[model samples]
Target: MTPSLHPTPATHLPLTINDSIVLQSMLGVGAYGSVYKATDSHTGQTYAVKCLSKTGLDSRQRAFQTHESTLHSLVSGHPNVATLHKIVEEDDCLYMVLDCGVEGDLFYTITERGGFVGNDVAIKSIFGQIASAVLHCHSKGVFHRDLKPENIIMFGQSVKLVDFGLATTEQVSSDFGCGSTFYLSPECQGGYVEMVKSYDSAANDVWSLGVILINLVFGRNPWKQACPRDETFSAYILNNDFLQTILPMSTELNEIIKSVFCLNPRKRIPLSDLAKRVQACKQFTTPEFSASFASSSNASAATATIGQSGVAGGTCFVSSAQREDKDQGDSGVDVRSRA
Candidate 1:
């Protein structure tokens, strides 16, 4: 008998722009907007709709939108990156409908399942996919200012880089000093005036990737030590010294991170070399990893809830319970904008 191909509860129901996409449940909210799983009435395809409230958008948001639009134009067609289906506006509010992948963001995965994946093969596989996406962005003269676990999405074993809100074009010099402060490059923190002229955004992304790789292995931000501090970027650059803690990793992996995270942009490891090194690592050829890396089943029943539960501006994502409650039926339905 052929297997039944019914849509899982996670499928988003369609809605139009201007009309309220039923708030099935909040998927996630960031500084600019909230993302919810919504369906398109016309196509029956699931999409992630990012809703930016007019009330919340300030000058910073304007700059973000401008850069985001530029990056979207540059990288929209690439498969490794999130596909932008449509951009809609209602009054001052802006809604962007993006392709909703089978699995969700990598940060949600790593957060719920403890820190850093233990499977070496899994890490290499995911890393390669992410690198391909990043490399594509680079080829188009776009730099992803923020490249972290929070922005990566996993579908089975494959990964796609999402959240291009911080992406900037290569031709234009970025004036805004934005991105999660933790992932900010040392030069970016030195004030835009000083760093804009010499800022090598490609290298900064490399550094951020290095930080993310460390987090994948250790489960926490490598630069985060002695309780998070509110230090300036320059101060963090001067005092940041966590390289010694990497003694636990294999020497090859350790060297890769070091080279990628080099303080000098010109001297940092190129993506081409990094990709080659990761593939050549001993972990890549191991029998266990080679065989089982992409075979894992998507059986985890945790339904994610994004956006702040109670706080006006706060956002959070949590997994759904194993058994779906009748009252929680709306949790899996998609919410869309009125067309």
Candidate 2:
């Protein structure tokens, strides 16, 4: 028989979901909640379960949580984004079982593996995966407002973008002052003062991608801020030839970077076009970045064999990387429909 899951009111942790699942240890705390490394007691399969308490969540916080769950579930099957195994909702908390990223986040990986100076291949492969993920998100009308290294978790040669606390749909009313400071686009910088006009989330993501690519190649950001007022940014704005001296990169790469870093959002390459350009760039296929990612298909098959189902009358399985299920909700019905 399936056992009842008990809630720890004091520590706010679920004691155990059933006879099949056991909470092992705390992973880390997020902006909204805590994550735990858990194991399937029956098959010994491991997963990460993020826990968010409903105790004191204000309406705004509740809304964000709902939105995150909605977006995360919608984008779960993408290879470049973390997969959601299943979501277990209790009266006091929401348990999100996600794919485990054992290698840690991108920031730590870069710091430990030595900067990308001679490892151009890793740079291209990693950036390509990220671009693909962003393109997929854009196609679904979901925008990941935050795109910093810390939010990108690495699994050896592969990566999975996480932390959708700041994500929003295209039709939603967006607020100003979102995302990290260093990765902000020119429009994002401008949007702070011009509160009346909302920034394009997709374009802002492209600009941040430019910053990320530059950091991966050069080992540091070119400027502290992307606004025209910033001295370094202003210099680049005035001199079209400045990147050549600073990057020592091929003309094709330089052109791609310039297109992404264009101050005018309208002029920046769309994610669809950027994906093609980046893929076509000969630099991506260079010997250094040719390493292959661990197969998610294999992982999914393993998970399906061991992951538990029939938990409190809910189903469970590792989301397939090739899933083509579309979100059919036209409004606020997303979370309930998916769950």
Candidate 3:
């Protein structure tokens, strides 16, 4: 009755590989690095993976990475700011995995949609969200050197300030010129290299924010209209003529923008007071504007089901639940991603 017994082999789970997190397609590329849409194998979550090449790992790049690491360490649990999940290194490349925004950058959204959101109440509500995030950054002593629309992401009702690659600490006196030229403060662009040594990064960030607000309202740079040439643009900003052009916006909104973009860094509006000034604006109290703002806020949530992959070669999926929601209203609004 004794029969031959067979030994069983144990099964092991497959190890996760780098390639498994495929580069669906390039989201965007710049001098610093390129970002990609990658799927995490372990959790099947989508992430925006920013990779810094070996050749691009200069002193500036290293310094940026260090500052970003510090910021992430300090504000680890903040919901309004983008969360850094992991930093993966493969040979010479450094990959930063971050929470992917389903709705993508706010700049792209505004640029693609040809509509002016001039309702003051709507502007105030959106501005509050942005200011809250920026104030949090200042409280942490981290100044975002580059705070343009391209760096701000919108997910549902929340807006996160991303691209800390150009961000710096309070003690950092001077580093390489990093920010976009269009958003740079006067002192930052002054001819004297030594002048930047005295440049206050915090105030500079405020100026950039003002420029962003102006762009949001006008959909174009205030200075861009005056000086089409690069040299003229530099001259215009240095002479403070750019301030005059921005004054055409409402008196309250104009004052807020001016306070932030003051040529004298010491006179610039501190992040602590931004929320109060934004609330004081007349635009924040109108019922019609409030309704419009609420609708725009919902627009981001509505587009959440849009595919993370670009329009090149991926299969876009829209669930039945999402379809039903889309059919409820505003089905005519174009949800195309920017090139």
Choose the strongest candidate by lDDT: 2
Give model 1 RMSD, 1 decimal: 10.9
Q: Count the backbone clashes (under 3 Å) in each candidate.
A: 16, 2, 2
- Model 1: residues >4 Å from true position, as ranges? 1-15, 18-24, 54-66, 114-116, 171-176, 191-197, 225-247, 283-339
Which ten contiguous residues of candidate 2 have the minimum total lDDT? 330-339
Q: Model 2: per-residue lDDT, tens digit, 169-209?
A: 86333565566655777666554234336678888888888
CA lDDT, every prediction? 0.55, 0.63, 0.55
Can you write out model 1's per-residue Cα lDDT over 45-89, one digit (the tens) per residue? 677776666655678766666567557656877776877777786
RMSD of each: 10.9, 14.2, 14.5
- Return the TM-score for each candidate structure: 0.68, 0.74, 0.68
lDDT of 3 at 288: 38
Q: Give one digit per residue, the lDDT tens place, for model 3 in 166-261.
A: 666763446534465556776666523234455787777777777666655544444421222444344444754443332234556656765775
The list of candidate 2 runs beyond 4 A from truth reads 1-14, 171-173, 192-196, 283-339
Model 1 residue 123 distance off true place after TM-score fit, in angstroms: 0.6
Query: In candidate 3, where is summed lDDT lowest over 10 consecutive residues?
Result: 327-336
